[model samples]
Target chain A: MANLTTKLGRLQMKNPVMTASGTFGYGTEYSDFMDLSRIGGIIVKGTTLRERQGNQYPRMAETASGMLNAVGLQNKGVNYFIEHIYPTIKDLDTNVIVNVSGSEIDDYVKTAEIINELDKIPGIELNISCPNVKEGGMAFGVSCAAAAKVVSAVRKVYDKELIVKLSPNVTDIAEIAKAVEDAGADSISLINTLLGMAINSKTRKPMLSTITGGLSGPAVKPIALRMVWQVTHAVKVPVVGLGGIMNATDAIEFMLAGATAIQVGTANFIDPAISEKIVEGINDYLDTNNFSSVTEIIGALEI
Target chain B: MKKFILDLQITHKVQLNKQNVLLKLTSKDLLPEILPGQFAEIRVDKSPTTFLRRPISINFVDIAQNELWLLVQIVGEGTKRMAEMNPGDLLNAIIPLGNTFTIPTDKNAKVVLIGGGVGVAPLYMFGEKLNRMGYKCVFLLGARSQSDLLLLNEFEKIGEVYTTTEDGSHGEKGYVTQHSLLYNPDFNYIYTCGPTPMMKAVASYAAKNEIFCEVSLENMMGCGIGACLCCVTDTTEGNLCVCTEGPVFNINKLKWQI
Candidate 1:
C-alpha cells in the first residue's frame, strides 16, 4: 500500500487533496455529500476581521471551460468563526485550515492572530490573492515586496504553518513566491484565480456586476502547473498547486509538476466528491507505479 | 431539506415546441416529498462548456411511479445538449432543492398563477397541489403566440386558464399583465415566474393591490447548494441564495425595482 501522508513544515495532511477555500463553505456544507474527515484538509471561506456583505448581485459569469466570480469573500468575520464555526469543526479528524483575507494589513494580522489561538486549527492559508475585492487583496499579491510585507507581519503574530496563497496576475510569479519564502512563509500555494472578464454582446454590458472577475476552472490548469514547477524550483518551502483541477488525472499532473500538495477549487462545484476521489486516485496511481510513498511523485517531471 | 443524487433514466421525451421539451425520468429509489417551486440541478455531461449543473424547476413529480418531470428550454449549451438526448439515456441530478411556494391555507383564499415563456414549468405542480387542497386556482399564462404557449391542457385540468400572445394570436392581446383577467380584484394571492420584466410587472400589480405575492427567480447558478454564492437574489433581508433560500420567495422578501 502507498503511504498518502504529506507534511508542509509543522502541519501534516492525511492526503494531499485539500478543498480550496471559498469553494468549500465552512467544511460543514459538504458533509451532506461526502465525509469531511477523509480528505487532506478543509480550508474554510475567506474570513476577514469584520462581517462582509461582499459584492452586489450577479456576481458570477460562465465562460468556456470555467467560470468568473466576484464573490468578494462574504463571511461573517473572524469573531463569528471563533464564536460559532470553530467549535463545530474543531474536533473533525481532518486538518482545518482557515483562509484569511482582509482589506488592510492590520485585518490580515488580526484575523491570523485569532486563528492562531484556536487549538484545532494547525495553519492559516493567507489569501493575499483574492481578485474580487476592491482593495488590499490582489494588491499585496501583485508585487514581491508587497507579498513579503504581509507574510512577515503575520508571521510575527502567528506561529502556525503559514501558507501564502499567490496571485497569477503578476509579471513574475516565482519572484513573489521566493519573497514570501524569505519573509518566513512556511509554504506557498499558487496560483489564485487569473484576472479575467466576459461581455454580453446583446446587452452590451459586462457579464459580472463587478465588470471584471477572477476566473477559475479547467482553463487554468496549464498555467497553474507551470507556476507550481517554477515556484518549486525557486523556493525551499512546499508548494500547494491549485487552479482548475477537475479530476484525479489533473491532480496527478500537478503532483508531477512539483506540487507537494494540491487544492481542488472550481471542480468542487462540478463534483462535491472530487477531493475524496482525488485522494483515492492518488493512492491508486502510487500503487500502480510501485511507489511505496506519495512523495516520490512530487517534482518527478522527466523534463 | 432532504437531498438525493439519482441516476434517472429517461422514460419519455416530448418536444413541446421549437425551443422546449418535456422530459420524463424515473429513479430506482422512492423520491422524497418535493414541494412546488423547488428545482433539481441537472448535470449536463455531453457539453464541455456546461461544467456546472443546470438548475431546472420541477414540472411534476409522481410519487407512486418514482417518476420526475423537467421542462427544459434550449437556451444555452446545457439545455441544447439536454434537448438532443433520447429515451433510455441516463441523467444525473440533485433533487428537492430550494424552498416551496406558500400554499394558501385560508378557506376563502383565491389564487392566481402567472407564468411567462419557459417560466411556466413550476406552475403546473403549484396548480395541481392547490387543486388537490380544494382551493380556487386561476392561471394567466403568456407566450409569444398560441404555439409558444405550453401545457394549456395540463393547466386547464387544475385551474381556469387565461393566456396572452405577443402577436395577438391568442386569448387577450399584448403581454400577460395586460390581460383582462388581471384587472379583476378577486384574487387574494398571486404566484409568478418567468421573464424578469413580466414578473416585475405582476409583482408591482400585486403590491399595488396589497395582495400576497411570490416570485421564483432563475439566476445563473453554479452549485445548487448555498455553498457557491453564485445564484443570489437580492432580498430585503440580504443577498440570499436562489438555489437554497428560494427558487420561491414572497415578493415582500424580494426588493425588486417595483
Candidate 2:
C-alpha cells in the first residue's frame, strides 16, 4: 500500500480524508456505519460561545446535484461540548478537531482557549464563514481585515494548531487566505459553502426559511477547486480543500489543486460510510499510479 | 437500536394508484428489528435532480415472509424515481432510524390510529403491532376522494377502518376530524400522521378532549440522523431533531398552536 499520511502544519492525518464541519457530528454518530478511527480527522459541529437555537424550520432545500442549508450553528455552546461531548470523543483514535464560531472577537477567543485545553483535540478550524447565522459568521469572513482580526485574536489564547476556515462568499478568497495566514493561522481550509437560494415557483416563496442559505455538494466543486488553486498559490500556509467532494476522485482533485489535505462535506449526508471509503479510494489511486506517498501529488498538476 | 445500511432487493412492487406505489423489499439476512413509526432513508440513484436520500416511513414488516414494506407517494423527483423501480432491483437504505411510537401497557385502553393520504403508511405497521398484542385497533383514514384512499383492504384486515374524503365519495364528506366517529367517548389515546395542518387539527381535538395523543411529523430532512440538524421541530424542550429525537412525539411536548 502507498503511504497515505499527510499533514497540515502541526496537524498530521493518517490520510487526507477529514470530514467537513456541520456534516459529521461528534465522531460517535457514525461509529455504527464505519470505523471512526479509519478517518483522517473529524471536525465536530460548529460550537459557539453561547447556545444558539438556530434558524426556523424548513432550513434545507435540495437543488440539482446540491443542497442548501440555513441551520445557523445550532449548538449548545462550547461548555456543553467540553462537559458532555468531549469525554465520548476524546478517546477516538483519529484526530477530533472542533469547528469554532462566534458573534464577537471575544467569543472566538474564549471558545478557542477552552478547546485549547482539551488534550485530545489537536486543532481548531476557526469558522468565519457560516452563512446561516445573523451575526459574525460570514461577516468576519467577507472582509480580509475582519478575517485577520478574528484569527489574530484567537491566536493569542489558542495554543493548539489553528486552522482558519475561509468563506467563498467573498470576492477574493486568496487575499483573505493570505491575511489569515499572516495573522498566525497555522493552516487554512477553504471554500466553506457558497451562498445561494432556491425558490418554489408554485408557492411563490423561498424554499428555505432563510431566503438564502449556504450551498454545498457536487454543484460547488468547480468553484471550490478554482478557489483552492488560487489560494494555495497566494498563501504560504498549508491548505485543506473541500467543496462537493463526493468520492476519492474528488479528494484527489483537491490534492492536485494544491490542497495539503482535503475534506468531505455534503457527501456525508448521502453516504454515512463515505469518508472511510474515500480513504480506501485514495490508497487505490496511489497504488495504481505508482506513487510512493500521498503527499507527492499535492500541487503536482502539470498546468 | 443499531442502524444498518443494507442493499435490500425488491421482492414485489404494486402500484396502488397513479400517485402511490407500494414496494416490498427483502435481504438475504433477517431484517433488523424495526419498530413501528421508524423510517428508512432510501438512496435514489440515477436521479439527477435528487441529491439526498429520501426518508420513507416503514409501512409494514412481514416477519414470516422476511419482507419490509415502503408505501411511497410520488410527490417529487426522488419519490417519482422510487416508483419506477422493478422487482429484482437493489435498493440501498439506512434502516430503523428515529424513535418509535408508545405502545401502552393496558390492552383494554381505547386506542385510535388516524391517518390521511400516504400519512397512513406508518400506522399500518403500528396497528398490526397493537392488534398482535391483543389491543383492538380503530383506524380513521382520510383522503381527498374515495380513489385517493390507499390500503383500505389491508387496513380492514387488522382494524375497524373508517375514512373521509373531501369529495364525499368515501365514508364521510369532510376531513378526518369532521367524521362522526371522533364524537365517541372514552378515547384514552390517539396516534396520527398526516399533513401538518391535519395533524394540528388532530392535536387540537385531542387537546380539547384531554386525551393522550401523539403525532408523527414528516419534516424535510437531510442525513436522517442528528448530524444535519435540518429537520428540527419547535417543541416544549426547544428545537429538537425530528429524525433522531422523533419521527413520532407526544402531543404535550409539541408547541402546536392548539
Candidate 3:
C-alpha cells in the first residue's frame, strides 16, 4: 500500500508492474484469468503501419531457461489498433502504452501521429529493439545517430510521453541510451532480448527459420540487469527495465539498479497471471517492511 | 478463456493398445472450455533432466464428469514420462490454446473426419460433437502399424469409422486415401489434423478430388499465442502465426509448402 504507486516519467502507473508488448496481446485475451484494471499498465503488441505477415515456420526456438523468436513485428497495424483494439482497452484504468514499431522514420512518426489523436492512451513506447524483422528493429536502436533520428522525428510530431525501448543486441547500450535521452526521450526501457539461437542438433538444421533470433527469459536476466544499471546511470531520464523478470525479487533488483519502473516480459509466457502475482508480492513486501511508496524504493540501493 | 498452469491429475494411465497410451485425467472445470486439436503444454517433471514442458494434442473431453483423455505416443523424454505418470500425480497443462477445428454451418450435410498419427486426438472429438448434433459423420484414421491404431472402439461409438495401416495390419490396407477412394464420400466438408506429410498427402488428395478440407497444424511454439511468432506456415497470403491465424486452416485457403 505504501510506495507501490509510481511514475514512469509523465505517465503515472497505479503500480510499476506492467505487461511487456507482444506478451499480453492488447490486454483482453487473458481476462479469463486476469482482471485488466488491477495491474499498472498494458503495452499492447508491437504495431506497424501495415499488417505484418511475420516470419516462416519455426519462428521461435527454445533455449536454456529462455526462448528465441523472430516473429517479425506482426500486428493488425496502427489503423486497425485504433479501430479494433483501442476501444476495448483504452478506457481501462491501467495505463495503455502503445508500443509502435516502424521500418522507417516516417512510418514511426506516422504511427505515433495516429496514436496521439486517441483520447485515453497515455504514452508511446518506441520499439526500436525488435530483432526478428528484416527491417528497422535493432538496425535503428543499435546506432547512436539512427536512435536519435527516429526519436527526434517522433518527438516532433507526437507531444505525448516517449519511452525508448533499448535493444540488448547493441554494443554499447549506455552510449545509445544517452543518444535517445539527448534526442528528447522522456524515459528509457532497457534490454529487450539478447540475440541468440538454438539448433535441432539431430537434423543438423537450424532451429529457427531466421537461423538467429531474439533471446529472452531468465537466461538473459543477469546481462539485462547489468545493462539496466549501465543505461540508468548514463541517461538522466527514468528507465523501465525488462528481461527475465520472474518474481518480485527480480523486479526489485532492477528498481535498485536505477530503473524507475519495470516490465515483466518472458515470464508471462509461462504464467499469464504473473504480473498480478508480482504486483501483490511487491505490495506485501512494502506493507510488511513499513515502506511507504514504491517510487521511494526505486534506486534506493546504496553503493 | 483463463489460461492456467493446471495441475491435471492423471486418473488412469494405460497402454491402451500398443505404442499408444490412454490417460484419463481428473481436472476441475477444464473440459468445459477445451475443444479438440487445441493442445496443452505439459511440464513433465518425471525428473528434472527433462523439465521443459511438452506440447500434447488433446484427444477428447467428457464434459459431464470433467474427465479428459489424451492419446499419447512415446516420442521423447517429456512424453515417456507422461506415459509413466500414475493416478494421482499431477502434470502442469496450459490448455484450450491455439485454436480449434472450424465447425461447418451445414448441419444437414454429411461430414468426413480424417486424422493421421496421434493427430487422431482432435478428429475424434470433432466427430463426437458433430455426431451428437445429428450430422452424418465418417471418421478415417491411419497409422503405420496395427499397434499404432488407437481408439477404434471409441470412434465406432461416435459414427461410422474406417481404419488403415501402412503394412496391411488393419481394416483397410495402404492409407486413409484408400478409404477416401472407396466411398462416394459425397461429403459436404472434410476436417483433418495430422503429421505434416500426412496432412499434405490428405490435402493433396482432397484438392484433386475438389472436396472441402481443413487441416490442423502442429508447430514448435514458445508462446502459444502470436507473440513469439514461432508457429508459422507459408501460405499464398504469405506467412502467418499458426497459433493465432490458425492451428486450424481451410485446406484450399492454405498454400501448403509442398
The per-candidate count of clashes, in order, stands at 0, 0, 7
Name every residue pair that clashes in candidate 1: none
Model 3 misplaced stretches (Cα beyond 4 Å): B1-5, B17-19, B28-33, B43-55, B102-110, B134-136, B179-185, B225-227, B234-240
Cα lDDT tens digits for candidate 3, B1-258: 555667789888878765669888977654547876677777776343452356677788888868888889887666777887788988777776767777778888767888887888878888888888888888888889887878888889988888889998887888887774435747778888778888888788777778788898887765675555567787766777677777888887788753
Evaluate all candidate structures by whole-model CA lDDT and list the values in order. 0.90, 0.94, 0.82
TM-score on B-chain, cand. 2: 0.98
Q: List TM-score per model, in order.
A: 0.98, 0.99, 0.92
Candidate 2 vs candidate 3: the TM-score winner is: 2
Candidate 3 achieves a global lDDT of: 0.82
Model 1 misplaced stretches (Cα beyond 4 Å) = none
Give the per-residue Cα lDDT of candidate 1 at B225: 83
- C-alpha positional error of residue B43 in candidate 3 after TM-score superposition, expressed in Å: 4.3
TM-score, prediction 1: 0.98
For candidate 1, lDDT tens digit of each residue in A1-303? 699998977888888889999898877877877889999999888999999888887899888888999998888899999999998999999989999999899999999998999999999999999999999999999998888999999999999999999999998998999999999999999989999999999999999999999999988889988999999999999999999998888998999999989999898887777788889988889999899998899999997
The CAPRI class of candidate 2 is high
Which number leads on DockQ? 2
- Scanning candidate 1 chain A in windows of ten residues, the lowest lDDT window is A25-34
DockQ of 3: 0.47
Q: Positional deviation of A132 in candidate 2, in angstroms?
A: 0.7
